[model samples]
Target: MMMKKKSKLFVNCEEAVKICDKSQYNEAGLWDKIRLKLHLILCGGCKKYSSSNSKLTSLCSKAKLNALTHQQKEAMKKVIESESAK
Candidate 1:
């Protein structure tokens, strides 16, 4: 129907954002990417948001960040607990 076709081509800002994130992770479907690109063309705010998201993703990959190890995390937790107990 008309509604279904409209929904397929257009997306709100929130849905656009979700699709943008999924696209970044290579998880978005082709239809979703098409919808997101259409929405971004029509919505400046979403376009800006998608651009920023891409930049952040690129920066994070370049940074090559790492999370604390289990031992490090346990040590930090114990320190926090001990401090709180004092």
Candidate 2:
């Protein structure tokens, strides 16, 4: 019996997802991008996920969303604590 070695370009779904996320953030290296693209070619689910991720990122960027400041979070927490105590 002969064992075949795994190709360096082969990536499982999990790793593909991680790579997809990194690619979205422009954090994936060239090899990782190539692996992700190859995996996406064969994986319908991951392809859909990548599409949705891209759409979501685009929507978030266009939405101009803002986060609460630390003071606002502390105020909200105090309010919640007081309400809980009531």
For all candidates in order, the CA lDDT equals: 0.94, 0.95
For residues 1-86, write the lDDT of model 2, one tens digit per residue: 99988779799999999999998899999999999999999999999999999999999999999999999999999999999999
Whole-model lDDT, candidate 1?
Answer: 0.94
TM-score of the candidate numbered 2? 0.83
Q: List the residue pairs that clash in candidate 2.
A: none
Models 1 onward score TM values of 0.82, 0.83
Q: What is the C-alpha lDDT profile of model 1 across 13-81, one tens digit per residue? A: 999999999999999999999999999989999999999999999999999999999999999999999
**What are the C-alpha RMSDs, in order, of all predicted structures?**
2.8, 2.1
Instruction: Give the distance in Å from residue 51's predicted Cα in candidate 2 to where it truly belongs.
Output: 0.5
**Ten-residue stretch with the least lDDT total in model 1:** 1-10
